[model samples]
Target chain A: MIRFEGITKRYDQQTVISDISFEIEKGELVVIIGSSGCGKTTLLKIVNRLIRPTSGRVYINGADTAAQDEIELRRNIGYVIQQTGLFPHMTVRENIEIIPRLKRVNRADVEARSVELMRMVGLDPAQFLDRYPSQLSGGQQQRVGVARAFACDPEVILMDEPFSALDPLTRVQLQDELADLQARVRKTIVFVTHDMDEAVKIADRICLIHEGGVVQYDTVEAVMKYPANEFVADFIGRNRIWSSPAFIRARDIMIQTPVCASADTTVMRCIERMRTRKVDSLLITGENMRMLGIISAREMQTCEDRGVPVSRVMRRQFEKVSPDENIVEVLQIVNRGGLSAVPVLDEAGTVVGLITRSSLLTTLSRPYLDETEAATS
Target chain B: MNLFTFLVQSAGEIATRLFQHLQLTLLSIFIATALGVPLGVLISYRRRMKKPVMGVANVVQAIPSIALLGFLIPILGIGEKPAVFMVVVYSLLPIIKNTVTGLSGINAETLEAAKGIGMTRIQVLTKVKLPLALPVIMAGVRISAVTSVGLVTLAAFIGANGLGYLIYSGIRTLNDYQILAGAVPACLLALLMDFLFSLVEKMVTPACFKQN
Candidate 1:
């Protein structure tokens, strides 16, 4: 078990993490979720002695991390960062063999271990043994990063936003890969991310950090069901609704018959549809019903000057949420991406409906307002 | 100047010159690498000592090889001793600088990983740090080797038998053929040594060290 006892880290006069305490059992995956500057990263660094606490202690299997030789202490823990941090000059095989070589393992043993690690991380040894880090894509680089960390069969792993650099699809794939890898390796893992869906997906226990301390740490279901305070409620955002937004999908909240414009449709015609439907944006679809772009009502006023087709003035990079995505995820997608609304797409990537900022806000606010009304009554 | 006659006449001279050139250049580099690498490693670890050690190396590098040879002749006299001493001094900077740079350039993450794996200090240095530092150090050695080859040619000023003798003789007699003979072999030797050492560096370094 890894334990942090009253860990307090201060930078100058201000505290970054103050008197934080937690225990992670072997084979458990604990995730810390918080907004930026919430000290989740600082807390993980403290466990590895990368950043030492000012007044508290970290113990690995009951031995104080501060008291142990730092080098030896670090060797027992695997660390993965969002950047992957793979050594740029080394080949994938060499990167994985680093820890084994450091342990003075026999040459044959090191090679064998490297091959196994490469295979374990899903990189074919034959194909990638000589390939350098720069040659791999972002997702592949992260796999090599993971392989390097697990090189020595470390018992505990610390991951700080390891998959945050990848695209959403790649992020989801890697998260699943991580879950599988963790199940097999069974290392005590402390993962940090600001994404709640990712935290909920993989965490055996979730710790919600706020103002440099853990506001809530419990099972994923428990944390979602019973948030500790208003900060967590706000941080988790849209999930504190009494009906629990987890059960509501984007399809339920989305407008089924969304106003859409075609590529050949005139700008004036598109404006008429927006005005008649009273919608701020219209999805521009292609012949095969593929999403082309989104044209906002504001663009219609300047449509003639901006013109060629609806496609000319439409926003190509627009927010999209899947029909299967829960309302909380949709809200997160809207809020995090700073979009006023998002188009809900089916499995085929065709726009099914639209979800607006006001609809989501109403859905999220209803439960809290109802509670306030009950108190007043 | 018949080809057969030319070969028969210069065979002994060519053999003698080749052996001598190889002996002088190799001997100086061996000595410099032996002495400079450790000093570089030592100074690299101690922040305060780096400037002083590099200062000494820089001063040694600044001394012209002919001047150093001429100065050394007074104390050690003519022949291989003065020549070897001068080549060794000239080769120190690259070897020492590369060694320090190589050791210091080891990835901090790799070092942390090494420590995380339960390796002792000595184990980490020997296995992780030294192996990773090998390429940079080899680069240094390559520079030292080439520099030694060029500097050893100047050693002929002190009567040492090497390719330098042919160049000095050519200059004295104004024989273009003799000068070509000296200059060609020296350049070829430097290139040959570089290629050979690079192969050796590659072989000694594990494939993993190439990832970056």
Candidate 2:
């Protein structure tokens, strides 16, 4: 656990952080979010003594961090920054092995650890271990950054907007992978970002700072549902309709028990299932319940004439949403495509539910939603 | 006699002076690097000290080598010692200035990453900054070396043995052959040192930085 008490930093006459106090518990992921110049990065730096506080103290595991040697203290904490900061001259394996080698760990063990870490971060050890940072794409470099951070297996990891430099698609993919890795690894993490949606998605609790002070520090749900003040409300309320509880997801609003079929299943059987369910389309899935595509009645008409399987006639290109994706984004897809329904995929790419126009329309137009919908949007 | 006949006749004299010239340039640069590299590292970290130190180097560099060697004659006396000492002073600026540039030229993010990952101050300098700065610093060494070879011919004025002895003797005796013997070897020596340092630069360059 880490604790910050009355921590403040003043540069000349400008106070960048002022009397900010917070505590992060064991195995918890705390996100520090603020607009630029709010001293959020300053706060993260103080934990490892990168920046000394003008007054107050930070304690790690009950020992004051300032009292410890900065080098030794930093060696025990993992840090990942926005640029990925990988040494351009170092191979991926060498980059990850740096800390372990510094600790004088044997070469064989360090090599094994590098391979394991690369695997943990979803990089293939054989392919990427020898590549330099300049050779990899931005997202690949960031993944190497994360793996390098975890190489020493420190109990606490600090990530400062690690995904912000990546393109949005890669950013979202990394975020999902990070969340998945955190579930398996379970290290206490302190993430800092300016993105509110990211904070809502990954944080166990959020510390929202404004003007060198924390405006609100609470669980994701609490910060969204009950903002402490107008500043907190306004800062968080910008383009963040997804956080409010009144905002339904594709999973909740989807017609659960979606009439889905395995692609290998006969077209006649899929027609029978659709007839029984009174549906015009059937969701197609493959092994591990992965959604492959969809076959509508219009496209399936060719199956009889051509005597082909359903997979042959199924439409391969379509917009699919995850279970957590907001209904607003889903509504646009459904209305724009004139889709009878869109499939809701879980994190594993398995079809969890189906959101048809009527189902989403009724959910969006519900009288109870009007208050939050008006307020958040 | 033809210049080729003149060269063959004085080959032994040329070779001996060539040895002396090579000796003077190498010793001075060796001492300069030993002193200048650490000095550069020190001032880079203590940025305020940089301007004042660089000002002194620039002033030293502005003094013509002949005048500086002449100035040193009274205090250190003439011969190899004073000649070597003065050239060392002349060589320090390039090595020092290049070291400063090389160290300072490293990306801020790379340094932060090194520090953030818990490298000691010394480790960051040696393992990270020095390796990246090698090519730049080597370029400085190359500059110092090429200049020093020509400067060593001036050392004969101070009575140091080198190709400079023949050139000076040639001027006194109105003999172009003597001057050509000294002059040709010095030019060749400068080219040789430059070529060797280029090899050293390539060898020190990190693998990832090498272009395909």
Candidate 3:
């Protein structure tokens, strides 16, 4: 855990950070979100004593960081920055193993740790271990940066827009990987990024700063549902928030236990399920209860007339979404494909629920409705 | 007599002059690198001192090589020492200027990363800054080597031994073969040293620095 008390950083006549104070709990991923020059980077540097605050104290694990030797303090704290900051002279293995080597860990143990760390970050140890930073792509260099941070096994890690330099696809991929990696091996991470969307994806708590001050710092759910003021609402883009719900998942609003039948079922059975559910289509569940295809009543009628199984008539190319995905993506799929609905599958590939177009419209209009009602009062 | 016959007959004298030329150039360059590189690295770190440091180097470079040797002769007395001393003064400009430029040219991002990852100031300089700056610094050294070889030919003025002695004596005696004996080898020596230093520069420079 880390705590900042009355931290104000002034550079000559201009103040970089103005009396900001906050606490990050253990195993929490706190994102410092702001536009560039909002002092997010300056704030991160203050944590590791890279920048000394003009006033106030920073405590890491309940010890005043100012009292500690800067190098000794930084040695136990992982610091990653934008541009991947990889030592160009060092190979991937050497870059990852640098901290351990600095700590004077045995060479064999360091090599062993390097292999493990590379695997943990989804890099192939055999192929990339001996390669230079220039040899790898931008994303690979940042992954190596992450591995280097974890090499020392520091209690806390600070990342300053680690993914900004990467392309969009690589950025998204690395974000998902980092989220999954953090879930498995939770460290108290303080991430700084100028992007609001990235913060929403990765942060447990978002600390939105503006002009060297904290605008709002709270759980992502709270920040979305209750933005505290007009500034917070405007800063997070009011239109986007109102239109696209935050902290929403497919499973949260999906109609549970959608009408379904086995893929091997006859057209007669598919018709019965569709009639009972008062729907036009029947979700055909295949092996392991996964949604294999959709059998429309029209298709089922054709199968019935032809005296064949529903599997022979069902549409096998229907799109499905994971349970944890946001409703924005679900609506996009529905709108783009002109589909009435899409199945929501859980991690096991089981059809947990169905996302209908009607369902999305109802959910999307509630915020505006509430605003209208609040205005009347 | 032909140029070959002249060289063959006076081969002993030519060989001695070659050794002396090598000795004068090499000693001057050795001292220049030893003193210049550190001073260059120092000036790089101290922003306030850069103008004054570079200003001194520029003035030294502006003095003609013969003039430098002549100026040192009065203070240090005419000999190999005065000859070596002035070459060092003349060569210091390139080595120091390049050293300063090389260190400054390193990516600021790389330096920041070095510090962020808990590198001590000394370690950052030695491990990151210097290795990254190696090619540029070696470039400076190469410049120093080539110029030193050319300037050592003028050492003949200060009673120092070199192939220039043959050229000076040949001019006095109006002997064409002797003039070629001194003139040809001095030009060849400069080329040879340039080639060799280029090899060294390649050896010391990391492949990463070469690309950018």
Candidate 4:
């Protein structure tokens, strides 16, 4: 739980940060992202008082950070930097134990925590604890950096471009590990990065900043689907969400209108509606669009009694996806069962939209075609 | 008598002079470290003091050892006091300069991390800056120690007892054997100081810095 209020920083005649304000909820991974020189890093540093704001207030857990002693304030907050910032003189164990030891934590307790943290960050304690920072590869060094931040068990962690310096493969691996780590620890973390893809992958909420001001702060899905302005959309690249399939939800690509019929409708009448609507199946619904079941064209063709109610002939057990479910699960369900369509239901089982096979194909291919069209044009 | 008989005859006296020479060098080095390290650490943080402090040390280094002893003689009478003071002044430049260089040479990221992780200024110095800069600091001490061995030979000029006594007196008397005895032992002491300090340097150096 952290809040920034009217934080402004002026260096000489230039304004580095101007009247920026936002709040990060507890146990949420909020990413502050912008292009270089957009004050994202400066914003992160303000949280720990590494950079004093010219005029503003920062509150952590509702306590004003300025009122707290800097050393005491920082000891309770974890910090990780892009360079890994590990002390080359100290071994991994010492680096990780620095804060806890400074806090006068018991020797045995800190030592045990150092070992556990090493393991949590995917480093073996027995092998890595005594090795100096120079002995580790860049990725391993960053992992140790992460472990060191967690060693004190601080409630809030601040990470500034923690994975930006690593190679692409290692960066991806560290990002996944960080996301997993956050999931397990549930610390309120404020991560800063310039890359939109990374923000989308790991951030619970993305805070987009431009020229020392908040442009858009919303959930990853909301930000992706509805960018606030041209700068926000351009910065997040139109097809960026497509690269992260998880952001492509069922509601985003589903057909809002689907052919429907009352459950009491006779099979003869359902066939007439299907043929007229140019459909192969009908989603049978009760009063208020509540999903009843489905009756495919093939099922209707073999119906012995044409005048029977559609509910009696409909298949009750059917594959479905919620509007919020990502495209990956929708694809899996389609591939696994060879279903022609999947109904999108809301919390109350109301059939809001239909994700037809053709619709899924068009939604997934649009990104590629748009790129090619842009290239040719 | 020939050089052989001369060396055998003066062996006892040479041993005593050698001990005096070592004592002077070690004492000067010890004082230099005590003064130079803290000064170096201070200048590294109080950057305003760096230029003036380094300038003074540089001026001291520019002064010849004989000249430094000459300046000290009037203030501190003709004896071991002047000799030790001259050596300490000469040793200050390297120890202080190296200390500054070493401390400042520490990775900026490491220092930031030190503070970022909530270490007080003192803790950062003790835990990060000093430990990381140790090799360079020790290197300065080694230089000062080895050079001090040769410099202390000038102490004999200030009426101090050391191998320099034999060398200067024998030069006046035209006794080649006495000159050789003093000169040879002083040269060997310099080498020995280097060897001893190298061992210390290795011992204190972090494992990662060591070559396998």
Query: What lDDT does the true structure give each of the candidates?
Result: 0.81, 0.88, 0.86, 0.91
lDDT measured at residue A159 in model 3 versus the true structure, 0 to 100: 96
Q: After superposition, how far is residue A25 of candidate 3 from its true place, in Å?
A: 1.0
TM-scores, all models, native as reference: 0.67, 0.79, 0.79, 0.92
Better of 3 and 4 by lDDT: 4
lDDT of 4 at A161: 93
* Residue lDDT tens for model 1, A210-273: 8888899898767765678877776776434344457567877787877788877878788888
Chain A TM-scores of each predicted structure, in the order given, are: 0.65, 0.67, 0.69, 0.93
* Highest-scoring model, TM-score: 4
Q: Candidate 3, which segments miss by more than 4 Å at Cα?
A: A239-246, A249-362, A366-377, B209-212
lDDT of 1 at A196: 83
The CA lDDT at A190 in model 1 is: 92
Show pairs that collide, candidate 4.
Answer: none
Per-residue lDDT for A1-377 in model 4, tens only? 89999999989989988998889999999999999999999999899998999999999999999999999999899999966498876788888887887778899998888888988999999998999888888999999999988887899999989999899999998999999999999999999999887998799999999998999999988898899999999999998887788878899999999999999999999999999999998999998999999889999999999998999999999999999999999999999999999999999999999999999989989989999999999
- Candidate 2 C-alpha lDDT tens digits along A1-377: 89999999999999999999889989888999999999999999999888899999999899999889899898899999866488887899989999899999999999999999999998999999999888889999999999988988999999988999899999989988888888888889999999987887778899999999999999886787578998988888743555454445666678888888888777877777888988989999999779999988777766664444678778888888888777678877887888888899988888888988778668755644766787799
Candidate 1 CA-lDDT value: 0.81
Pitting candidate 2 against candidate 3, the one with the higher DockQ is: 2
lDDT of 2 at B70: 86
State, as a TM-score between 0 and 1, how close model 1 is to the true structure: 0.67
